[model samples]
Target: MKRKEKFENRKTVRKTECRRSRNLGSCPAAEVSKLQKTVNSFAYTLEKAHFLDYVQYASNEKRIFRRAFLTGLLRGFGTAVGVTVLGAVIIYLFQALAKSNLPYIADFISDIIDIIEKTRK
Candidate 1:
């Protein structure tokens, strides 16, 4: 009979232990600490992630691209300047020739007018 009583007491203790464990899930302290640890770990990893490395890599790529862009722009500008200088020289030579050949001025003017009219048409 005493052995049966001991077994019943042990069963009661086991039942209470199971109920306590289930209630722990609803406990405020346990829930708060669980959430706190998760938040802390997320914040730590976020702080550790490197952003400067990405910025430096982007800046280096931009610098290389910008350098190439500037080089191409300067080359195009130089070619345009050379063409303009050649055109100016040609125009100056023709003007000089026209001054010395007064009779040709009328023909030159007629040719200029025809080119303008053709381009307009």
Candidate 2:
């Protein structure tokens, strides 16, 4: 019993020593530290992979598809609103410029308007 207990204690100590050497840097400190960092990075990567797996398993494909569809729909709506606002601002700017008493500017505006009308026809 004593011999068996001694062997078991030594085995446990060896396991702990290995872990301690990895974590607390007993020897080959720099290399061990790099390895520990890499192991920690892998741990994080594994956690992320698990999280993604859970997300995939818990959510149906229809849910994911709806999420993607809504995202695209919102994006398209934003683009349309942005273009409308931009066109309104441009028209307001041109109208403001037309109101100014600059003869050359008025002629330029009339020429632009004529070109637009020609395009419409």
Best candidate, TM-score-wise? Answer: 2
Give the per-residue lDDT of model 1 (tens digit) for 84-111.
9997686666656655756868579557
Superposed Cα RMSD, model 2: 10.9
Angstrom error at residue 119, model 1: 8.3
**TM-scores of the models, in the given order?**
0.35, 0.51
Decoy 2 TM-score against native: 0.51
* lDDT of every predicted structure (CA atoms): 0.74, 0.78
Tens-place lDDT per residue, model 2, 1-121, is 7999999998778666766664554545665678789999998998978977877766798887888899999999999999999976876777677678579997787677667668879
Judge candidate 1 against the unseen true structure and give its global Cα lDDT, from 0 to 1: 0.74
Query: What stretches of model 1 exceed 4 Å from their correct place?
Result: 1-60, 102-121
Rate residue 82 of model 1 by lDDT. Answer: 100
Displacement of residue 46 (Cα, Å) in model 1 is 43
